[model samples]
Target: MAQPALGPAEAEGPCSTPLESPVHPVDEKPAPSRLVPAALQHIAAMYAGVVTPPLIIGQAVGLDQAGLTRLIAASLLIAGCATLLQTLGIGGFAGNRLPFVNAASSAGIAPMLAIAETSAPGHQLPVIYGAVLVAGAFCLAIGPFFGRLLRFFPPLVTGVVITLIGVTLMPVPVSWAQGGDKEAADFGAMKYLALAAFTLTVILIVQRFGRGFVRQVALLIGLLAGTLAAVPFGLADFSAIRSAPESLDDQDDGEGEGGQGE
Candidate 1:
């Protein structure tokens, strides 16, 4: 005898199951219009950090203006290349293929400064380079094992490290708020403090009220706003950029004469 007609739900088969949807959607690539501004924001955020190391080291090594310019250019080039590699990655061996800014590390500053102080003036940079090469080799050797060690760093340890980093860097912003140079006539002036406070308030307001991309680029907005605020207080200076080329030209001429004498 034929069975009664089955309903649509049962007609497929007893084994049939509904297809499950993904809990989270994959991220889509952003359009060029959206990407350019985002990229600029990232660059603005990291620009100071990438340049500061070269600036400090160049001065510490007594590099002439031309030499310092070359050092700055090289630092920027290396940082851009490293950032590209980190973001795009090569084969499986290099880079994590994450959104990371690879720049001259501030961690090495103290060691590099120590090397500069203890070594002969002519040998200081070479010694620092040699140390860097050794450290790179050590890191390469330990790369595989390093991932395993990360499991030991639980949330507590991670939090402590992050807190310590913030604590260590706190003095930097304080110095900026005090007009950078402790010996300057305007150091710790009320005007500088007010400008800093205005910048901080702007940042907080943006973070609290701004939406989407505006919120994401809040730091950059804060920086631009702070500079504008400082301009009215006579704190924003453009003399350095105006004189840089002339200084470099003079240094190059001095070096040429010194080379002829040698």
Candidate 2:
């Protein structure tokens, strides 16, 4: 094959050599009308994400309803604080200064559950929290060098890991279907199972029949419908909500407890 000669313009162009910065130029400001709608969507996305990890881990660890509530409240507080810092860090001393939702993640659930099972009954939560703290510190320590490590994790490896995460998590929804109060004698009773089925049906119905915002929030709608449906079956528990802490300080006073979700 003949070697192609570079033209005069090609030789002089900026593309002749590699560019360094990867950041693309973007509009600094968005339409004012979009702000509220964008914020609402963010809240919607964060709703399920912020709740699931704490709910699952707390329940799996045998926390009572009060304890579970506290764990979830704490997770929400931490996620909110982290998100704010991530979006508005001063002088790049912390955070990425982006509108990123920093919330509890589901990735570490398996490991945390393993830790809970291995630890003595009463000591489960403390040991698991210690492991989490150490892991977070390790991640911070390696943050600057993490880019180079990505070379070892190509698309195929990442895809497999994601699929495994999904597979490993399948039991969680099943557990939810049974009943939140696993210790109750009537747990997984026909009524509870029927409620779960109805909730799923509602989700599917909305996805298939609704449009726009209704479809977008099908899961949430189904959840609300389920809660309402459960009232007649004596599955609803309103005392938890009534007794819930009024403020962060209240939740703090009750905290002896803690999920990874999104």
Best by lDDT: 2
lDDT of 2 by residue, 183-257 (tens): 788778888789999999999999899887677778888999999998987888898778877876766655634
Which tens-of-lDDT digit does each residue in 17-115 have in candidate 1? 544332332334678997788788778667766787777777677786567778888889999999999888889878887777787777676667778
In candidate 2, residue 62 scores what lDDT? 89
Per-candidate TM-scores read: 0.67, 0.74
Cα displacement (angstroms), candidate 1, residue 120, comes to: 7.6
Candidate with maximal TM-score? 2
Cα displacement (Å) at residue 24, model 1 = 12
Model 2: per-residue Cα lDDT at residue 190: 83
Worst window of 10 by summed lDDT in candidate 1: 18-27
